[model samples]
Target chain A: MTYERPPTPGYDLGMSSSPIRKEVDGALLAFVARQRPNLLAISDELAPLMAALDALLAEGKRLRPAFCYWGWRAAGAVEEDLDGPPGERLHEGIVNAAASLELLQASALIHDDVMDSSDTRRGQPSMHRRFEALHRAQGWPGPARAFGEGTAILLGDLCLAWSGEMFETCGLDEERRRRGRAVYDLMRTEVMCGQYLDMLEGTRGEAAVDTALRVVEFKSAKYTIERPLHLGAALAGGAPEVSAALTGYGVPLGIAFQLRDDVLGVFGDPAETGKPAGDDLREGKRTVLVALTLERATPAQAAALQRRLGDPGLDRPGVDELRQIITDTGGLAACEAMIARYTGDAERVLAAAPVPEEARAALNALAVAATARRT
Target chain B: MTYERPPTPGYDLGMSSSPIRKEVDGALLAFVARQRPNLLAISDELAPLMAALDALLAEGKRLRPAFCYWGWRAAGAVEEDLDGPPGERLHEGIVNAAASLELLQASALIHDDVMDSSDTRRGQPSMHRRFEALHRAQGWPGPARAFGEGTAILLGDLCLAWSGEMFETCGLDEERRRRGRAVYDLMRTEVMCGQYLDMLEGTRGEAAVDTALRVVEFKSAKYTIERPLHLGAALAGGAPEVSAALTGYGVPLGIAFQLRDDVLGVFGDPAETGKPAGDDLREGKRTVLVALTLERATPAQAAALQRRLGDPGLDRPGVDELRQIITDTGGLAACEAMIARYTGDAERVLAAAPVPEEARAALNALAVAATARRT
Candidate 1:
């Protein structure tokens, strides 16, 4: 299903965002349309690749691009002043660059699904699962699962490569591009590194809360938010102070976003989160929330949690039991408190940052939505 | 465990290659060194990632870089007159850009190993095998195989991302960089597309000989030779005709090179090939040779070949039996004849192209070595 915003209070930006979302979506569609011929040139059979990518790209909230667009606006591009050629060009560049983030995010999600063996994404079959079903339907030889996984890996690599290509071709001047490229390059590296750490932590078992937070910082805070804002600011030729301020605002808010995601993973409605609730528990995610739960749980509870967590077959009843234990032990409450604190910090930074009022207000609304939404 | 040139007559490019190889290796080391701190900032545990990448980077023959460098030379860059500041800078840029190809190749090889489920690469345990061993050593949770495969996937991604970063930072002027970037972008997309086709072909059983050759053309010919030459020519501001000439010379030679590889996979000595003899048979690679045998084999022979191919446990006798069928069916001879035809075509193109004498000599030598070497 496409990303439909839930009717949650205090989350709306109070602006009809359809046009802006349309522009972002339009950029992605055009880019993929450009790739269709090349993919067909390889083989007509490869056309399904473009379709699969289109499906994956269709459902994103464009959250990264929103942060990027707002960050660019905050860095001094006037909302209603993009009428001159120079302003228009800059605006277009911002939109295209922001759109590139969605492609990058697609790459990450596709690969992440393969790594996690996820069966679904965006409320549809994950890329691998989709391919697996194709293989089975066609009675293809070899292991269907391996073919699906391998194809997904290549597709992800293609998206990752195109992310850089799209950003480079976004029509930014050399100076602005160079600045953005630094962030872009480092962001890709750091995110991969963060993912490696996340994978590593999963194997080590019962990591310290601090280590889990570090994973969150790199994997979520920096990748999903801080770097996107920095990329936008850099593209806009924002002052160093502006970048610093954006980082200050982005990091805390990103942390809150991830913290809320952790909460949603355990307790949010499946319909709202677009994921099976308690997935983090089932997948044995070494999240800060789980770490906190371990730290706070009694010996018996901790043993029980350890026994049930990471059990792939853990059912709905088991999920409820785990949830009850987490809440009873105040693990959920502590996680909620941390989310509130980070949200407060983000709001404080946004207010102090020398950003334009229009962007500030939108960003404030986004922060509320990101942290407080059921999804 | 390292790529070593095979002995061949009349194929030597005079002057010891140690200096050239060192420069390419140095470029990779410096680039990775620059990324080390950024990686560590994500987590000190990422140190293993750096080490793994370095090891994989260390052993390659740098064949693609050599092709790229010689291709640049073929585009009319003077050999001994690169003393002026401008020339020196261009030379540095060429070397760095050529080195970037090696990184891309590294990414391809690592990912290829994972997809093929190969146990070894360049005589050592493949990246996934190394990681699997590490997982076992650490007594890490989760399936060791999955952890290993997942880590290899991410490492391949990091290398792929870094390839672009290094290419962009190779210090070419914007115009030249833009020219090269076009080829670079298409090359990446096409190669991944080719990889997908190759993987797809593996599952479709015995496809037509033409289909298998199409896979070869994209997966190896264009990617390994033609595009690299075009990229080098582009970086040098070579005329359109230079690109045309390079393509004329590159495509046929690349095909021959891949044909030689197919032969080596089946018949070459293990020590010389640095891969197990009959590795291709065990992997059930859908090469042109396999296609040819399938086309020509009697019913019983075809059944035997189909049954033995892709069997992971196919032993030496099984390999010998398959080899006998291929030889009897004229598959091996036909493949050799095609290789000879392409080699002839490449030599003819080199003879007629307007590329200068020094580069022509090197290109002739490389073509000979590339197509005729046992390894």
Candidate 2:
């Protein structure tokens, strides 16, 4: 049965018709289309790989690219008139570069799904699952799961390399590319480390709140928000203070964004979030919310949470019981409060930053839309 | 219990103490050391991740960097006199840039080990196996295998990204790095696609000889040999013909090198190969040797080979049986002949190419050492 999404106010991730979002979509499609021939040149058997990548590339929020574009705007591109509307100042090369971040995100997601053995992504079968099914369907020999996992792993690797390749070939001059890549390189390393931390945290059982927050900081706050902004600022040749200010806003906002995602993973409708209900519960992600819940639970309640947490066979009733435990113990409220605080901090910092009015307004809109979304 | 390596007539990899090899080893250690602080800053837990990477980096053939260096030497760097020995012509920046290829190679090997589920690499526990032991030792929660694979996957990704970062930071000017990166980037994508094809071939059971040869073309010939030389030539700002000449030599030599590897996988001493005897057979690798054997085998022989192949639990007796079948069916002899033919082709092309005497000598020696060695 499909879990229906309740109506939420304002726009959604891929539903936004904004020019920046549209440009990112177009750039991603064009970039992927351009890369198809090389794989085909290797073998027609690689056609499935291209198809898998294409399907995964579709339907992103384009939020990272948005942050990047606004980062550049905040830095104030010298040739652009600050007085013009935001849509009027778009540069194709800059947008193309920003869109490359989506490829990085896709790579992370594909690998993450394999690590967690996830079945679904964005309401579709995960990359590994797709290959698993393909193997079964084709009556291929050997373990279907292994074949699927191998395909996903290799595809994830391809996406990782492609992200860098696409970024380099995005029609930017070598100087800009060289500069932007510093932040890009750091971003990749940080995210992988963050992932390692997240995986380690999981194995160690319930982690301290600080450990969970650290994962959020490295895996989400920096990778998703601060670095994208820094890449944009660096490309625009912005001042150090400009990058500093953007970091101030980006870090907090990025944390809030992830916290919201955490909430959605458990509570959001499967139809809206495009994931199975209680996926974090099933995977036993060491998010701050889980850490806080473990902190406040009584002995029996903690034991109960542990029994069902990370259980792949967890049923709907088990999910309800865990949700009840979290709510009763104030974990959910605490998580929401943290989100509010971080979002407020981001908004305040953004309000004070000396950015162009158009960028400022768009960023404010994005922050609200991101955090306030039910999904 | 261990197989002893028979002494070769001449110098072998990592033993000659050649200046180029020494430079590559030193550069790799220094580069990995420099990146350690950032990961430690993320979390002390990541210390193991770094250690795993360091241990894996400790020993390698370092062939890619050597190829890149020779490619540059062949192209004629304007600053260096071509009459000197290969060692004197080494530029630190260019060598460092070339050394970065080791990271890419490491990334591929780590992931390849995970995909193949091989327990050993370079005679040490494979990355996933190391993590598996760590998980068991620590008594971590969840399945130990999952944790091990996740760690390996993330580490492989870090190396992939680090390769690009190291390449950029290799002190080469933007023009050189940029030019070389085009080749580097293409090499990465091709190898991943090649890996995908290899995985697919394995699942499809015994495939056609053409399919197996295609895997060798993309996975080994281009990735291992051709691109590194092209990268070197491009960095030296060589003329178009220099790249073409290098490719003409590299492709055949690389094919020969892989054929040597396939033969070694079956027939070589485990000590020399640094892998288990019949590792490819255990993993069900659909090599050209396997394809040719199946083609030539009688029904009974083919059935006998199929029974033990890919059964991970196959013992020493099983390995011997498969080896006997391969030899009986003429697969081993055919593979040796192909290696001889390709090596001869490569040497002839190298002899005719308008390259400097010193470079020609080193490249010829490398070709001989690469194809003729037991390892």
What are the per-residue Cα lDDT tens digits for candidate 1 across A191-258?
88889888888977855889888888888998888998888888777899989988898999988889
Model 2, span B163-239: residue lDDT tens? 88888777766677778888998899899988888888888885578888889989999998999999998888889
Count the clashes in each prediction.
0, 0
True contacts kept of each: 0.76, 0.88
- In the range A1-375, model 2's lDDT, one tens digit per residue, is 111221452234322545677878899999888889988888888898888888888866677888887788788863354333443333776788899999999999999999999999877899999999999999977789999999999999988888888888776676777789889988998999999888888987855788889899999999988999999988877899889988989999989988888888788788777788898898888788888888999999889988888999998888989999989989899999999999999999999988877667767877787687766
* Best candidate according to TM-score: 1
